[model samples]
Target: MFFDKSHLVALGGNMPSAKGESVETLRAALDRIASSGCELLAVSRFYRTPCFPPGAGPDYVNAAARIACDAAPEAVLNLLHRVEAEFGRERVKRWGQRTLDLDLIGAGDAVLPDAATYQAWHDLAPDAQQSEAPDRLILPHPRMHERAFVLVPLADVAPEWRHPVLGRTVVEMRDALPDDALSEVVAL
Candidate 1:
């Protein structure tokens, strides 16, 4: 089916789910997403990266997927959350290790809430970022450009996708990071 826009979802997991291995869980999630109405366009090779807090948990397997869908951004995000739940993901701690993590990175050129609100969260202090979560969806993922785990795999599937607010392509954003920033994301 033809879709009105292209969407991006970032996937990661450090723990095995009820489905078994982390990789298998991710593959199953992809199938679930495809069956939930989004057309699977492209999938990036999984990369292994250390847990965010340095030693929080086991290293995570991360990847990105490009999807085509006509659903509203909120609806698509809801679908992603549902898939995560199916994989036994829990939100006990902010940025905690998980069995499955699916994030709605962006959809077409749409920006949620507004540019200013998105920017505020995007530029939030590291301490504040860890303790707070937005009340609404933010488009193009405010911090997408700042994470190697997100960018490296995203480059594999959507290198040319530009952030609607920042006007930077995925490649550009990935390139702007410090040289050692992406050293940990080794392709599997």
Candidate 2:
């Protein structure tokens, strides 16, 4: 299989709409991928949290899942983009509200620390810098330590999941978060 190692996938946004797409619409998207031949690994508990951009918006049902597929990394990314389009996601606004958001969090040990990954970081937050300390996919992500949304549930399923860069467990990172920031989970 091209994806011999387990992959961490996350899905979010609103529930499916009759005239538009939403979180509930993600099931069909997953079904399509399954029909396409990807093997299901595990699905995390769904979480209902506030929208990432804040303001008066609908809450999002977030969850993580593991998958094994016979597609290359770039191919997998392309498929994710296609899935997002099918769900009504648009590129008009960065991190803007959407119907469904699917992200291939990690794929095996493929460390793609180049300009592209850094570009993604920049897109996430222009001020975010690529530090050298932890070092996973450029910088900022640093083994997923800085991302509570990624670490909390990731720890739930893969408690012992190690950061390819910092060498710390998910639980440790979660524990290390400032209490105020930990409260942000409710704001997700």
What would the TM-scores of all predictions be? 0.96, 0.75
Which ten residues in a row are the worst by lDDT in model 1?
Answer: 1-10
lDDT of 2 at 53: 58
lDDT on C-alpha atoms for all candidate structures: 0.91, 0.62
**What does candidate 2's lDDT look like per residue over 1-52, in tens digits?**
3333566677777646333444456566677566667776776666666665
Model 2 residue 179 CA deviation (Å) reads 3.2
Predicted candidate 1 versus true structure: per-residue lDDT over 102-126, tens digit per residue:
9999888888877889889999999
lDDT computed for candidate 1:
0.91
Can you list the residue pairs that collide in candidate 1? none
Best by lDDT: 1
Cα deviation of 188 in candidate 1 (Å)?
A: 0.3
